[model samples]
Target: MTTTLPEAPPAEPGLKAGLKNRHLSMIAIGGVIGAGLFVGSGSGIATAGPGILISYALVGVLVVLVMRMLGEMAAANPTSGSFSAYADRALGRWAGFTIGWLYWFFWVVVLAVEATAGAKILAGWIPAVPQWGWALIVMVVLTASNLVSVSSYGEFEFWFAGIKVVAIAAFIVIGGLAIFGLLPGSDHPASGFSNLTAHGGFLPNGPGAILTGVLMVVFSFMGSEIVTLAAGESADPQGAVTKATNSVIWRIAVFYLGSILIVVSLLRWDDPAILKDGSYVAALSSIGIPHAAQIMNAIVLTSVLSCLNSGLYTASRMAFSLGRRSDAPAAFGRTTDRGVPRSAILASVVFGFVAVAFNYLWPDTVFQFLLNSSGAIALFVWLVICFSQLKMRRIIEREAPEKLVVRMWLYPYLTWATVALITFVLAYMLTDTADGGGRDQVVLSTLVAVGVVVVAVVRQRLGRGAAHDAVTSSKA
Candidate 1:
C-alpha cells in the first residue's frame, strides 16, 4: 500500500488577474523609486559628497544581484508569499515562517510611516484638517482602491508611477543641461566633474563613508523586490520577472545614481542648500524654478501614497499566501465574493490605523519604536532570498532546467559574494557610529534581527510537536 499525502487547499478566489503587463512593468519601476530617493538623497550627498554616486552604485549592484536571484525563483513559482514561499520550498518551513512574518511586519510598519508622512504634507497644504485626519483620509482612500480589485490598485499605481518617472526623467534631463551650462541664464560654466574632487577629494570622509552610506541606500532599494511579488499575479510571470530583472540595474544606475550626480554637480558638496533642502527640491529651486518646494512636495506626496497603496496590497497578499500554506490562521487565506482577501486587507489596515493612533498620541515614543524595530527586516528578507535561490537553483536544474530562463548569472559564486557583502555591511553598521543616526540604525536593526531569530526557533519547535502528535494519532 502507498502512503498518500494531504491535498493542498485551493487558492482563494476573487484575486482578479486584472493587473496587465503595463501595470506590472510600471509598478516594478515605481516601487523601487520611493520618496526616500527624492527626500533622503540630500543627506547621503552631504555626507559622502560627490562620492555618494559611488555609494548609490554600490547599493544598486547589490539590489541588482538580489533581484536577479529573486526573479529566478519568482519566474519559476510565481506566488504572493514570494521569498517566503521560496524559502519554504528550498530551505525549510522555519525559514519560510520567519521571513514571511518579518516581511509582513516590515510593510505594515512602513504603511504607518508613509501614511503619517503623506498626512503631514497634506496638512501643510490645508491646515484646516488635523494631521490625524489627513492620515485617516489617505489610509481609507488607498484601502478602498486596493479593495476594489488588484487591477484597480495597479491602475492607480500606473498613474502614480507615471508621474514620478516623468518627473525624475525631466529632472535628470533638465539638471543635466544645467550642469553643462546649457540652460538659459546659466553661466556656471560646465562644472566638468570638478565638484567631485573640489571638496575633500572624493571619499572625503574616507572610504568608510561609502560603507556608512550603504545602510541608507540599501533601504531605498527595499521596495524594488516587490516587483517579483506582484509579478506572480500577472498574466505572464516569467516574462514580467525577466524584463524587470534585466532593466532594473540600468534604472537604478540612471535614476538614482544619475540624479545624485546632477545634484552634487550643480551644488557644492558642503553647500548649505544641500543640507537645508532635499536633493531634488533643492536642485530645482537652485535653478530658479518657482514654487519648487511645493511642486516637489506634491510629487513626494504622490510617491508616499503610491508606496502606501502598494504596502497594503503586499501585506494582504502575503498574509493570504501564508494562510494558504497553513503557516498563518486559515481565515487569512479566505477571499470575498470579489476574490479580494477582505479579512487580510482589513487586518493589515487596522494595524495601520493603530500605528497612526500611536503616531498621534505618542509621536516620539511608540511610533519611533515601531519605525526602529522594523527597520532591518528588509536585509533579513534579502538574505533569505539569496539562500533560497542558492538551494532552489539546483532543485530546478534537476527537475526542469528549462524553466530557469532567468537564472542568476554565475550562479553560486555571485550569490555567495552578495551574501558576504551584505553580511559585511551589517557588521559595519553595528560598529560604525560616526553619526548618531548610524548608531541608532545599528541598535534598531540588531534588535529586529534578534527578535526574528527567536520567533523562528519557537515556531520550529511548535511545528515539530504538532507533527509528532499527528503521527502518533495515525498509529493509534
Candidate 2:
C-alpha cells in the first residue's frame, strides 16, 4: 500500500519573470564574490596563513550543501520568498515570519555597509563629493534601478557582476602565470608555490586556527543564496535554480579558493605588504602591476556597488514576500504596473538610508550595534534552509516525485549532517570569546533573533484567536 502526503499549499504569487538566464547566471556567479572577498581575505590569510585554504574549503563545502538543499525546494516550487516560503509550508507560519524579517533586516544593514564602502572609494577618486554625498548618490541610483523594473535591476547587476567576475578571472590567470614565472613582470623574487610551505610551513598556527579562520571568512559566503532567491523571478525558475545550484561548487572553488591560493602563493602569508595592502592588491603589486592599488580599488568599488544593487533587490523581495503572508503591511505585497513592489522597495531603501545615517553619525557605537546584531543572520538563514529541506524533501517525494529536479546529495543523511555542521559552528561561535567579535555577534544576533521569534509567536497566537472568534460568531 502507498501513502500520500497532503498537497502542499500553493506558493505565494510569483514575481515578474524579468530576469533572463544570463542575468541569473551572472547573479549566481557574481553574488558569491562579495566585496568582502576583495577587501577582507587579507585578514583571513593573516589569521590562518596558507592554511586558509582549508578554512575556505570547509566553509565552501558547508555552503554547497546548504545551497543544494535550498535549490531542491526552490526548484520544486519557485517563489519570491524562497526559503522563507518553503519554511512556511514545511515548517509553520512562525518559521516563515521570523526568518523573513531577519533576512530583510540583514540585507538592509548590508545596504549601509556596502554604501559606505562604495562612498569612500568614490570620494577618494573625486574628493569634491563628501563621503555621505557619494553614499546618497549610490543608494538613490540603485534604488531607482530597482523601482524602475526587475529587468533594470538585472541589467545593472549583469554589468556590475560582469566587471567583478572579469577582474577575478583576470587576476587568477595573470597571478597563476606569474607564479610559474611566465609573466614578463614576474620579478617578485618571493613568488611561487614555495611561499605556501616556506611561510610558517602552511599550518603555522596549528589546526585550531582553521576553525578560527572559518569564523572570519564564513560571512563572505552569504551572497551565494541570492541566486536561489533571484531564481523566482526568472523565466524558468526551476531550470535557473537547478543550474545555479549545480554550478555552485565550481564557482566557489574557482572564484574563492583559486583566488586565495594565488594570493598566498604569490606572497608569503607573513609578508608586510599583504597585511598593509590587502591580499589582492599585494599580489598584483608583487608582480609589478602598475597602479595596482587603483586597479584594485576600482574592482572593489564595483563589488561594493554590485552588493548594494543586489542587497536592495533582495531585501525588497523578502519584504514583498512577507507582506503576501500578512507577516508585514499589506502595502508591501502590492506591485506597480511595471510589476515592481514599489512600496516594499521604498520601505527597504528608507531603512537603509536610516542605517547609513547611523553609520555616519556614530560609526563606533550605533553602527557596531547594527552590525553585530545582524552578523550571524547568514548562519540562521542557512540553518532554516536545512531544516526546511529535511521536511520539504519528504513532502515532494510523496506528493510530487517529479518535482525533485535538484536533489540533495544524500537525502536525509546529508541534510542532517549539514544541520549538525551548522549547529557546531553556532556553538563554537558562542563559546569562542577568543574571537572577541564572533562571540558578541552570536550573543547579540541571538537576542535579536529571539526577539523576532517572540513576535512571530505572538502574532500566530493572536491570529489563531481571531479565527476562533470568527468561527464562533458564524455558528451563532
Which candidate has the top score in lDDT?
2
Model 2 poorest 10 in a row by lDDT: 3-12
lDDT per residue as tens, model 1, 259-296: 88888888878888776878787788877777989999
lDDT of 1: 0.83
- Best candidate (score: TM-score): 2
Q: What's the lDDT for all of these models?
A: 0.83, 0.91
Q: Where does candidate 1 stray beyond 4 Å?
A: 1-14, 185-189, 433-446, 449-453
What does candidate 2's lDDT look like per residue over 356-449, in tens digits? Answer: 9999999889988999999999999999999999889888898899999999997889989999998899888876675338888899999999
- C-alpha positional error of residue 336 in candidate 2 after TM-score superposition, expressed in Å: 0.6
Residue 393 in candidate 1 has what lDDT? 93
Q: RMSD of candidate 1 to the true fold?
A: 2.8
**TM-scores for the candidates:** 0.94, 0.97
Q: Where does the lowest 10-residue lDDT sum fall in candidate 1? A: 3-12
